[model samples]
Target: MVQRLGSIGKLLVGVWLAGVTVATFVVIPPYQGLGDAGRIVIVHVPTAWVAVIAFTVSAVYSALFLRRRRPDDDAKATAAAEGGLIFTLLSTLTGMVFSQIAWGVFWNWDPRQVTILILLLIYAALFALRSAIDEPERRRRLAAVYSLFAFVTMPFLMFVAPRMAESTLHPNCAFIKGSDCNGITLQVGNVGLLGDQKVQLLGLERQGDIVVAQVKVSTPGLASEAILRPGYDLTTRSYTDRPTFPGQRFTLALESVNLERGEARINMEAPGSGLLANQRTLWVFLASNIGFTMLFVWMFLVRSQVLSLEVQIAQRKVALA
Candidate 1:
């Protein structure tokens, strides 16, 4: 009965993931600036999210192993860490593909990229440490302790560090609506920084229902400058045109304007910033997240069982010896 139920659950997960794949390509429309390359987000984001979950699961089991010294708990911890590593690798690979399509480069050493790479290295070291120790008990104890310390870095590396960087080209606004993602307000002749770019509002002009702001943008160190005219539609209360900055893929967008006050809120928008704003895209993205999470659970269960079996076999061999 348990085997039958497991089979049914596996079948359901397979069907659900297949549906997500179909919806990802067929249902969701191509993003405006990113084109079809934006579709990678469905897989990329979920894999990254699953990696975080897997690491957390591993940490929990590691703590349990420490408390009880149960071999099964250690097995589960190792299995979850393995799953986390695989998913993290997938996230990195898919991100590289997306980067190639959107940024015209495979690797740019962006802050997010650097942080994830560092995280990969940290976890990889844990496995290496486990393999070097010969005694099963010592290996498990040291790995449990190391895993707890490793987990302390995961949150900082994955979330906090990337956000702290001021000049990253990552589309943080796609998932988060933090103050950094929100644009800065500037009056005519006032200067402000938008994602490390210095911007001075030069002038504003009205053409029909559109309010156009002439923004003088300069890169860090005043190395390059350009005059950008981003347009906002007063009637729609949205940006009509986002002009790309000089020598960068990011665009300057007018978020809001107060004509009477001569002030405007301008921001730097990365490629695929508003990709999830579409109803179909958002629904499919959410479904994809759900599917990936379920898939992780399935993988973790199977892997942990196999690891537990191996541990049991090793114990029998030790008993005979």
Candidate 2:
């Protein structure tokens, strides 16, 4: 059964990889701001997604190990975590490349960057703790418990911390709202885009010489005639401000911020059209994420099998003794 599963996994992964490659290169449209460089998103986004998914799977298996005291469950948890760490490193490296292009720095202390670093350290410590322990049973139990505890940081580090931060060069949907990260919320009557009273602009997109933006803003007690002003243009992106004018034109600046009442300003860039507007890019990104996820599963299964084999060998040695 294990051999058959492995063969099937390998076959599926091959298909997934081929599809991702074609979609990323041949099918997807170039991003507005990043252009051909935006193709990196297909890889970078999927790597990060797989890392998080692996961590989630690890946590689930850890919980199962604690409840059932099964050796297979323990092996599965460790394997998933190992895969997660590997992809986390890839995600960070790819992000650095993207950062160098977007922000002109390889290692800026961006909020998302800092949080992901913290997450990597936490997982590295998990492995270190496992290695320091001598007894197999005790180590497995402790590791399972530690994995559960560490799982709490995953959501906060990857999602919550970045959002609560002051400012970031990273995209907004890196944590929440997903595809909606680059869009503005237009208040219809009372409810917000997130079904709340408040709204925030995720980011902005620009086209050629003209800056195009659509914001749906409604702040109770704030003026109905809120204006968006374009601030500094750093030659790469542009920022907008909430001036009194409704229809204003501006050039594409690197970090143009549009200041809103009681809200921190969001940096705007013309990353081409929105990802949603371009169906091909959207499908390519989606396919890439799914492909990487399948790769994660394959790695996890292979790692678990190796661990399980080692466990069996140890059992046989004990019997001989």
Off by over 4 Å in 2: 173-267
Clash totals for all candidate models: 0, 23
Residues 1-321 of candidate 2: C-alpha lDDT, one tens digit per residue: 978978988999999899889878888876654556677778887898899999999999999999998889999999999999999999999888876665445776778899999999999999999999989889999999999989999999988998886545474332221123333323222223321113434334445443434434332223453424344343444443322222211112223333242122332334335544577877778888888888998999889989999988998998999
Model 1 scores worst on lDDT over the 10 consecutive residues at: 171-180
For residues 218-303, what per-residue lDDT tens digits would candidate 1 score against the true structure? Answer: 76323557899999999999898888776545678888999999999988775553778899999999999999899889888889
Best by lDDT: 1
* Deviation in Å, model 2, residue 275 alpha carbon: 3.1
Could you tell me how far off, in angstroms, the CA of residue 210 lies in candidate 1 after the best superposition? 9.9
Clash count for candidate 2 is 23
State how far residue 11 of model 1 sits from its true place (Å).
2.0
Q: What's the distance in Å from true for residue 174, model 2? A: 12
Q: Would you estimate the TM-scores of all the predictions? A: 0.78, 0.72
